[model samples]
Target: MKQVRIHGPDDVRLDEIPEPEPGPDDAILAVAACGICGSDVGYAKLGGVQGPAPEPVPLGHELAGTVVAVGDRVRGIEIGSRVALNPGAAGFGLGSGGPEGGFTPRLLVRGAGLGKSLFPIPDDMPFEIAALAEPLGVGMNAVDQVDVQPGEKVAVLGAGPIGLSAIATLHDRGVEDIVAIDLSETRLEIARKLGAKDTINPKNDDLWNDLGRLHGTEQLYWMDLVDTDVFIEATGSGALLKKAIERGGNGSRISVVALHRQEVPVDFMTVLMKQMRLQGAIEYPERFENMLELLARRDLGPMITHRFRLDEFSTAFEVAKSPDAGAKIMIEIG
Candidate 1:
């Protein structure tokens, strides 16, 4: 067997190793497809999540595979069933310092019968699309953060994978007036495909002006604010936090979905005056079934824009790092 692991600082390798033997409660999956997330890119640079791993660490988390074999104690799940791994669930190595990850052909999942880490997928769903369960779950959390409802207006400040995922989730939840904001026209186009009613390219357009014009405006004391019901901050821009506060209507909910490197200052006075609710969102806690429901509703195959074979992983990583790269970069394994 071959696995992708970070050996040391900037030291990722494709090491040949023995196939894993499953425990009594474990199962072995013949890996299918894995999505290269932004975190995977960062971990590659640092050789681990925060620092170099004591041992070689597997580098992928967004993945789907089929069960090749299962231990006698493994109950509900069976061999040949397609399933998606919960990244938050430990054991099936996912960018964590450990034994393995899903970047290869075979993966050993511990406690497969415990019903904690794996969720079966529809037989008809492609492995590449099913691999999206993880990222889409992230998108679900962002939408859940703001409690977006039907008929409410939304403005997402980034059209990358997470932003686009949020937009798609909003659409799935029946939200109509959705606005996608990004500097890339291409990304905006993708956002539209994912159900963004309108888009704003901040490079040539004023984000505040366009938002106000589309969402309508409300007067608060001497200041005017965009009446958008929900604001999902998918771009990690400190300035956007201030802008959202400045223009966000009274009682509007703002969800910070993007990760920021530095501290972002906020005007608590304005937040206090408007009674706005600001929340931070990260991984999906317990919504694997919700992800499967969304995947059942639509063909997420379109979300995948680029695909590469396992052997061409270096090239795939390069493409994922490119600004011009399309929506989801997938590494298809046999």
Candidate 2:
């Protein structure tokens, strides 16, 4: 079997290794597709997320695959079941747990359990779309963190995969007035389809004015505040924190989901005076399989804008980093 391994900064390799043999309580998944996350790119830059990797580290987490073999102890989950692999079961997920990752042809799941380590997807759903349960799960978690109200307006700062997931989930929840704000018009267009009632590109139009006009405005002492109740900041821009604080209305919730590298100074006095909720969100506390139901219902196939084979992963990373790649880039192996 061949796997994608990160040797060091800007160094990745296709390493050949022996395939896994499932134990009595294990299963083997023939990986079909995997999605490259921003964290994966960051890992490549740092050599490893935890620390420098003396041994090359495996590199994939968001993935879907088919069951090629199942242990006798593994009941209910049978061979040939089309499943979405969970690389997050504490010490069991690919790349995160052991030597194996989904960037390979096949992976072994120890103590394979249904709804725990493996989630069965619809037989008809494409593996690429099923893989999205991972990222979308994080988005759902972020949405849950803020406790979104039904009537409150929302402005998502970044229209990336996770932000789009939040938008889609908001749409599913009947949030009628969503404002998707980003520099990428391409993503803004998709945001509209995903349930963003309004879209804004700061490069072309004034973001503050568009937000104020679309969401309505209230005077906060001397500053004009956007009346949006929820501001999901996924853009990782330090300046956005200031914008959210300055324009966010009283009692508005700002769910910070993006990973910021630098520690930006914040106006605690403003937060205190406004009584706004500044919340940090990460991971999917609620089940991501629920997202599978939404995907099955809406066929969010269009959200996936780019696809590449496992061998062309570098090219895939290039496209994912490119502004024109739109959203949700997948590496198809099966």
Candidate 3:
């Protein structure tokens, strides 16, 4: 079998390796499409804890595949069945938790653990769309944490794939007043198309002042600009998180869904004054089914912006890193 490995920084090589044999409780999936996640680019650029580059690391995670082989203990799922692979087998972090965990041509996923996190890709679900279920699930989980209520005001910081997913999920949940803030105009445009009621280019306008201008009289009563009820920080920057805390209204819930690089300073005074609730969210614990169900029903075909071949993995990573790339980028493995 041919596989791509990150031998070091800026170094990705295609190598031949023996196909994996499924354990008694595992099944083998022939990769159909794999989405290049932001985390994959992070790994390629910063490497892992082991060294400067995650040597011998496979570089994908958002994926969908067909079950080609099954183990003795595997059941329910059968050969030829198309499935979305939940890249985080154990979890997302160090060791075997990150994208390096799912970038292979064939994935050996534990059968019992599969549906608990994975979902059967509907026959009509295209491989490219199916590959997005994982990150969409992440966005779903973040929104689930906020428990967005209908007609409530919502603010999503960041316009990356997950951020945009949050907007779509919030819209689906009936949140009528949605404000999306990002540094990139292109991403904000994508957010608007995805259902964000308002888009803010934080670089050009004073986000807080604009909020006051938009909601004038309401700003006094709302105070923290969170009169909108919920605030979601998906930028993965601690500074933005601190700002979200400062800008959130009293009793407002702020869900921290992005992973930051280091310890970010926060104003305890601001957190105390507003009595804000800050919660951190990781990959979906059990939201993949609901995400798939939503995708299966909605007209979200435009969310996928680009596609590339497995051999073009390096270019795929570069595109993922590019600021102009929009929505999800999928790697056509097969």
TM-score top scorer: 2
The TM-score of candidate 2 is 0.95
Stretches > 4 Å off in candidate 1: 90-93
How far does residue 133 in candidate 2 sit from its true spot (Å)?
1.0
Q: What TM-score fits each model?
A: 0.94, 0.95, 0.90
Candidate 1 residue-wise lDDT at 185? 81
Summarize candidate 3's per-residue lDDT along 1-334 as a digit string, tens digits. 7776666766666677788887777777888887777776766565543447434676666778888888776668788988886655544431233433456677666543344434588898887778778888888788888778887778888888899888888888787788998888878888888788898887899887775555332343435354647778888887778777777677778888887878988888777767778888888747467777778877566667888887777777778888566767777887
- The per-prediction CA RMSD against the true structure, in angstroms, equals 1.8, 1.7, 2.8
- The list of candidate 3 runs beyond 4 A from truth reads 49-55, 89-100, 111-118, 215-226
Error of 3 at 278 (Å): 0.7
What tens-digit string does per-residue lDDT give for candidate 1 at 193-285? 889999999899998899899999999998888999899998788988888988899999999988776798889999999999999998884
Which prediction has more favorable TM-score, 1 or 2? 2
**Whole-model lDDT for model 3 versus the true structure?**
0.73
Better of 1 and 3 by TM-score: 1
True-structure Cα RMSD, model 2: 1.7
